[model samples]
Target: MRFLIIGGSGFLGAELARQCSTARHEVAATYLTRPGETTGVEWLPLDVRRREDVAALIAAFRPEAVINTASRSADWTTTATGAVNVALATSATGGRLVHVSSDAVFSGAAIHYDETCVPDPITPYGAAKAAAETAVNAIAPTAVIARTSLIIGDGGSPHEALVHSLATGKGRGVLFTDDMRCPVHVADLAAALLELAASEYHGIHHVAGSDAVSRYELGRLIARRDGLDPDRLPSGRRADTNAPGPIDVRLECGMTQQRLRTTLRGARQFLA
Candidate 1:
């Protein structure tokens, strides 16, 4: 199968590209600016925000599937435009698409969210992502909507950023105990996305670790695993006095794990 990964330069995208290449699939991954060289895979300069760029990519690659991991949710306008461009590109080619979303789309009110759960994103980033999902679904009903949580692994991931700060004795200054999330490994997530791409399954699915632990606990685990002093770690504070971050991001793995043979390991054990 020929696969094209949007945002293939990012950590998760690179991991997925590696897996697909190892499987002997024809893979083409797009990057925003500087593209990295990957063995057995073709790297292209792609910006999903541009319609002409997307059109050219489709015309040239004619991929069987296009996985969209590109988003500007950090900036509302860019996110909206980028998501729409992705939808148009895939819809035009009548190709399969997989849109990567975040668990932030949830309001964190429910103990656990299923595919049928209504999106009630609180933050601007979350709102934009939820809107992107709706737009993609409208354009291509068969497109896969994957909602994931904080991803760990890779040297430059958010998890690694925290670790680097702690190792340098900077994280001891502050930590958010109230802000908790289930951090999934990038490698595991890549496998799940590939499985979904190969299947006829559609709609939203959660791809996160099995454990839902507090940020403080996660810090201690990472420190302990790396032979650092766990006691030096600072406890967490609320993101705001009244507004607390999400605590339980525990996702119930159904289609991703069962049918795809992709298992999201518990963060506790994985980190340990």
Candidate 2:
């Protein structure tokens, strides 16, 4: 199978590329600023924000599957419009599209969300992700929109880095005890996404971890796993701050998990 991973330089995108390459699949990945270090992959420079560039690249590659993990939380043009561009290009090329979405789409009023839940975003980043989901669903009805939560890796992920920094007294920030999410392992997410791309399932799919944990608890877990003092990690309530986002958004992935071979390990299981 020929695979094309958009935003291959990103953490999740790079994991997808690495897995695809390791599986002996013909892989071509695009990077905005720099390409990933994944060997055996044909890296190409691409900015998904450019509609023409995305179309031309996808048309030329003509991959069997295109996994889009490109995201710019602060940039609506990159997160929403860029997704539209990728969807249009993938549709034109008749390729299987597996777009990675976020759990931020929810307002946390319900606290729990399934595949059927409608998006009611509060934050700008959440709104952008919701917009991307809408555009992708409209443009490519058959595409798999896998909505996930906070992605944690061995030691490379942002949250893990933060845990290390705070534990070592290098960073000055409190991990929110009220802010909750179902954190997923990067490897599991990438594998599940590949599985979904190869399957006939379409529309929205909630692909996230099984455990719902608070940011502070997650940080402590990371701290413990990395041989750091969990007590050194400061904690606070997100409600006390003016932070603009949902307090607790947990993605329910039971239905999607039944269809996937990869186990979405929770933060406790993976970090331990």
Candidate 3:
């Protein structure tokens, strides 16, 4: 199987590239600035925001599957338009597409969302993700739009780094007790995505961890896993802050999990 991973330098993208490469799949990963350190992958320079560049690359590579993990939380062009470009190129090339989405697409008004739930985004980032989903679905109706939650890793994720920094007094920010998400390990997510890409499934799927945890509790779990003092991690309510996003959006992955071989481990299980 030949694979093209868009935004391959990112946290989730890198994991996807690594897993695919390890499986002896022909892998080509794109990067905006610099490529990742993963060996055995053909690293290529790409800016998903540019439609021409994206179309040219996909046409040239002619990958059997293209997994789009690219996103910029604040940039609508990078997050929304970029996804549209990828979808168009993949569809034109007749390649299978697995578009990674986010739980941010929800407004937290429902707290729990299934694969059938309609997006009601509140924040700019959420709106961008929702727009991306709509475009991908429209352009490539057979594509898999996988919506996942906070992607945690083995001390490599941003939230884990933040926990280490705050625990050691290198960073100054409170982990929100009110903000909750179903965190999935990077390995599990990447594997599940690859499985979906190789399978005959299409449409929106909820891919997230089984347990929902607060950011503060997640920080404590990270701190404990890294041998840091969990008590040193400051905690506060996101409702008290001026943060603009959902408070407790949890993706219900039971249906998707039933289709996946990869186990989406929760924060407590993975960190433990």
Candidate 4:
């Protein structure tokens, strides 16, 4: 199957490209800033905010499956509107589209969320992700919205990097104990996503890890795995530090477990 991975240079996107390429699938990936070479994956420059560019790329590449991994963590225009533009463009192609979503879509008031749960975002990032999910569903119902949590792996992830920095006193920050996430392994999430892209699964799917852990705990786990001093990672409550942020956004993956052949291990389990 032919695959298109938007923002393929990113952590999760890069993993997806590598896995797909290893599986011997025709792969085309997009990059915005960081450029790197991955064998068997064609990298292209694309700004998802530009509809014409998206259309043009799809027209030329003509992939059977399109995965939108492009995201702007802080920018509203690029995060929300950019995703909508991708949905509209992908809708035109009639190809299978998998919009990589975030567990941040939830307000974190609830402990567990399934596909049927309503999105009640509390933060700007959460709001953007929720908006993108709505737009993608409305514009392209055939598209699969894979809502995942903190992507982590042994290879220096953002979370891992932060842990390592704090462990060595290179970075100074408080790890939040109140904030909770699933924290799926990049390899596991990417493998499951690739399967979904090839299949005809529609609507939102919780494609995350098996364990739910606090941000602070996740950091400690990474530190422990990498042989760093977890004591160096100072822990703080999100409610105490800043305004009460999303406390817990744990995704229920019963459907995903039964549906996909791929197995998503827990962050702690995978790290070990």
Candidate 5:
């Protein structure tokens, strides 16, 4: 299958691209700033914010599936509007689309946010992610909106640096005790996404790890795993801060697990 990974330059996107390439699939991954971490897959310059760029890529690759892992993350323009553009492009092809979404879409008001739960984002990043999911649904309802949790790997993900820095006392940050999430290994999530791409599964899918742990616990675990002193990790809560943050958004991923052959393990198992 011909696959296109948008924002392959990022943490998750690169992993997805790598997995597909290893599976002998023809893969093309896009990047905004620099070339992605993957080597086997074809690299292309893609900016999801630009319609012309997206249109041109679709015309060039004519992929069987387009997995949109692209995002400016906390930035609204690239994360929200950029997703809409990618969805439109995928719609133009009438191909299978797996739009990589985040669990941040929820406000953390509930415990079990199943696949059917309506998104109520709290933070700006969360709001952008929610909008991105909505845009994808509006543009291409057939697209698989896979909402995921914190992505971690074997101490290699770009997202892990902040935690490592704080654990070593190089950075100062408060780890959340009340804020809970399911952290999935990038490799596991990437594999599941590839499997979903091959399926006809549409609508929102909560693809996350099996373990639902707090941010503080996750930080301490990360610290211990990387040979850093876990005692340096400071614990706090979302309720204690004036800043906007989600409290608990643990996705009910049993439904997702039943659909795919791939197994999603917890951060504890993977990080260990």
Candidate 6:
């Protein structure tokens, strides 16, 4: 199958490109900045916010599957509408589309959330992602929306941030324990996204790690894994009063496992 991954230079997108190339699938990835070369994939330039660029790329490639991994993410207006437009442009060509989203879409009230749960995002980032999901569904109901949690891998994600902070030991020793998230490895998420692209399953699906650890616990775990001192790790901040975060944002993966029939590893497993 021919595949196109937007934002292919990112942590998740890079993993997807690598996996797809390993599987011997025809893959073409797009990037805004200078993306490093991959052995078996073609990297192209694309900005999802530009509809004409999206259209032209699809027309030239004619890929059977298109995955949107691009978003403003930090800004609501750009993320919501830009993502929506990209989805519309791609799906208009009749190819399957998969929109990579976040578990932040939820307000973190429910301990366990399935695809049917309604989204009540509190932050602008969450709101934009939620709105993008809605627009994607409306444009192509058959399109798969894979909502995932904290992505760990490569160098730019939260995982790297924590590791770097600890290694440098320059910042204040304050960990936001209140900000809860399931840590999903980038390789696992990429695998799930590919599975969804190959199958006929529709609607929202979760591709996340098995364990839900607190921010403080997660720091300790990483430190432990790296042979660092967990005792030096700071205590967790208050879950409610400290900052803005999801109280309990664990995703239910029953549907994903059953549909994709793929075995997903836990956070430790990935780190190992």
lDDT value, residue 36 of candidate 6: 41
Model 3: residues with Cα > 4 Å off, grouped in runs? none
Model 5 per-residue lDDT tens digits across residues 1-272:
99999988788888888888889899999988888767789999987888888988887889999999877655898989888888887788777899989888888878779999999987888899998888889899888999999899877775478788887788887888888899999988999999999998899999999999998899888888888888888888778898577788899898889999989999888878
Better of 3 and 6 by lDDT: 3
lDDT of 1 by residue, 82-174 (tens): 777877888788888888998888777785776677788878888898899889889889999888888877355877678658756876445
Each candidate: what lDDT?
0.80, 0.95, 0.95, 0.87, 0.87, 0.80
lDDT of 4 at 213: 88
Q: What are the per-residue Cα lDDT tens digits for candidate 3 across 135-213?
A: 9999999999999999999978998889989999999989999999999999999999999999999999988998899
Error of 3 at 128 (Å): 0.5
Q: CA shift at 21, candidate 1, in angstroms?
A: 1.6
lDDT of 4: 0.87
Clashes of 4: 0
Per-residue alpha-carbon lDDT of model 4 for 1-272, expressed as tens digits? 99999889998889989998898999999998765478999989988888889888988898899888878878887889888888877778777899999988888777899988999988898899999999999999988999999999775589888888888999988888878888899988898888899887889899998989898999888888888888889888877766645887899999877899998888879877
Q: Which ten residues in a row have the lowest lDDT in candidate 1?
A: 239-248
lDDT of 5 at 251: 91
- Provide C-alpha RMSD values for all models, in order: 2.0, 0.6, 0.6, 1.2, 1.4, 1.9
Once model 1 is optimally superposed onto the true structure by TM-score, how far is the C-alpha of residue 191 displaced, in angstroms? 0.2
Superposed Cα deviation of residue 53, candidate 6 (Å): 1.5
To one decimal, what is the Cα RMSD in angstroms of model 2 from the true structure? 0.6
State which candidate, 2 or 5, has the greater lDDT: 2
Q: Over the full model, what C-alpha lDDT does candidate 6 score relative to the true structure?
A: 0.80
Q: After superposition, how far is residue 156 of candidate 3 from its true place, in Å?
A: 1.1
Model 4: worst 10 consecutive residues (lDDT sum): 238-247
